[model samples]
Target chain A: MLVIRRDLVDAMVAHARRDHPDEACGQIAGPEGSDRPERIIEMENAERSPTFYRFDAAEQLKVYREMQANDEEAVVIYHSHTATEAYPSRTDIKFANEPQAHYVLVSTRDPIEHELRSYRIVDGVVTEEPVKIIES
Target chain B: MAVTVSIPTILRTHTGGEKSVSATGTTLAEIIDDLENNHGGLKARLVKEGALHRFVNVYVNDEDVRFAGGLTAPVKDGDNVTILPAVAGG
Candidate 1:
């Protein structure tokens, strides 16, 4: 299960909505060994395509170094599927190298309603998990 | 030409759970070769058909090697070689 804050969930949804028609990707960082996501680090979608998303290499390095200096790790890696369901695609599973992260998928296919789901993708296997939002 | 190579968590199995390891080489290719000497299965993960795998991002002191020259990028003593699996999807 992934326990996240309400504001964080809202922020992710907003980002997804802002980048509709193109994929949006980012990560949430928390103290090392802490699954609690306390900070959101939005990343540029280098590909900038609706079907693909990649973190810009230089920007990724910068954020990674910052996390290291602050003793934090990415607790959640998230992206939006503008026209698809909130589930990991074959491409998402293929490129998921972070075994310890919660892969959050937000689907904004419907303008009035959004679907959000979380999964654990490890070794080419994806298992959906429950998400509990804590009001803040 | 000693350099520090930082390993991402996913590849730690190749380095016996080591987060960072030292290898000696004047170029990125040579460094990978030296690393393979001690960590047997790593080269296969980072290199494919004699080039850096598209799935991995390698940097020498903050400069991404893809722009520098791929596997032939130069490295010097005390440089940091960081390998990160590209966070990407299609």
Candidate 2:
């Protein structure tokens, strides 16, 4: 049961569209607790794929540190598939470091085909989780 | 009995476009070597100089190999090994 914000999905879709032919990546910051497992604080758009992504390690570390400073945790990590579906690629699953974190994929291959899927990839198993979109 | 390994799109080119393949091994390392033997260059992408690729993640039945024993992770027949690349998207 993974809860995501509707706005976040929309943002991810927009980013995907904007970065067509490339990839869009971001992180989700939120509160951490059993009562409120995940909540989104903000979304970022990687400008370019620095060999792979526009955002570098420094930017990621900054965001992560900021989240920690705010006493928030990175609940979910997101990215877009400019020409692919919202399914976990073999590469995507292999890089599943945060087992507890939800991975949301937004596909912008077809503007009309807006698809957002969430999953929990622990170890190497990809498990589709129900995404509860919260509108704010 | 063989251990089943799932391939990702990025590395499929090395495996002759094979989405999944099966290899025999008692440990993950051996299985990886077997895969590379059948499919050249896959070993480099999966492992570098006998070490797991930094950007690539390996999972055994949905569990991250990082938390497991990594290359030494024990595997058995019918086990599913999924190879996923590290994707950074906003």
Candidate 3:
């Protein structure tokens, strides 16, 4: 299960809503070996395509460096789907390099509502996990 | 000194079912060469036409190397190198 702050979930939902037709992507980092997600880092989708999302290569490099400097690791990697349900695509499973990270998907198919879910994509396998929202 | 390269599940056949393998090099290019020498067929899968395959994403210590220097990105001992395919689908 992935435990996240309610505010962070709201921020992600807002970001997904703001990027309506286009998909949004971002991540949360936490201290290494600690599954607690504490940092919300919004990322620019290089593709900007409604059906696809790729982190800007340069920006991704910088964020990784920052996480390393802070002795942290990406605990949750998230992206939004404008037209699909909150689930990992075959592609998402293939690109899931961080086996320890929770892959979160938010669907903004509805203008005013969103569907959020989390999963573990490890070794090309996908396992849905429960999300427990907490108060910060 | 060796750098640990994490192999995606689909490509583990090239590494003989190993999830990760240690190779020696000062740069990513050299590391690929080393991996190719040790694990045949991996280089062809990772690179095409003298460049990293467009569908592939390589990260050193979780940092994608394309922005750092691509194939020439410097690497050192004890670094973690990750190679994954670009995600697709909605």
Highest lDDT among the candidates is held by which one?
Answer: 1
Q: Please, what are the lDDT tens digits per residue for candidate 2 over residues A51-105?
A: 2343343344455447657777557777777766888887677566666678877
Q: Give me candidate 3's TM-score against the actual structure.
A: 0.75
**C-alpha lDDT values of all predictions:** 0.96, 0.70, 0.87
lDDT minimum window of 10 residues, candidate 2 chain A: A49-58
Comparing 1 and 2 by TM-score, which wins? 1
Candidate 1 falls in which docking quality class? Answer: high
Where model 1 places Cα greater than 4 Å from the true spot, the runs are: none
Superior by DockQ: candidate 2 or candidate 3: 3
Q: Tell me which of candidates 1 and 2 scores higher on lDDT.
A: 1
lDDT of 2 by residue, B1-90 (tens): 498887865677787878789988988899988987898888888887778886676877766777788899988899988886654532
| Candidates' RMSD to native | 0.6, 12.4, 4.6
Which portions of model 3 miss their true places by more than 4 Å?
Answer: B1-31, B38-45, B48-50, B57-89
TM-score between candidate 2 and the true structure: 0.56
lDDT of 1 by residue, B9-87 (tens): 9999999999999999999999999999999999999999999999799999999999999999999999999999999
Looking at model 3, residue A90 earns an lDDT score of 75
Stretches of candidate 2 off by over 4 Å are A34-55, B1-90
Per-model TM values vs. the true structure: 0.99, 0.56, 0.75
lDDT of candidate 1 over A18-119, digit per residue (tens)? 999899999999999989999999999999999999999999999999999999999999999998999999999999999999999999999989999999
Can you rank all candidates by lDDT, best first?
Answer: 1, 3, 2
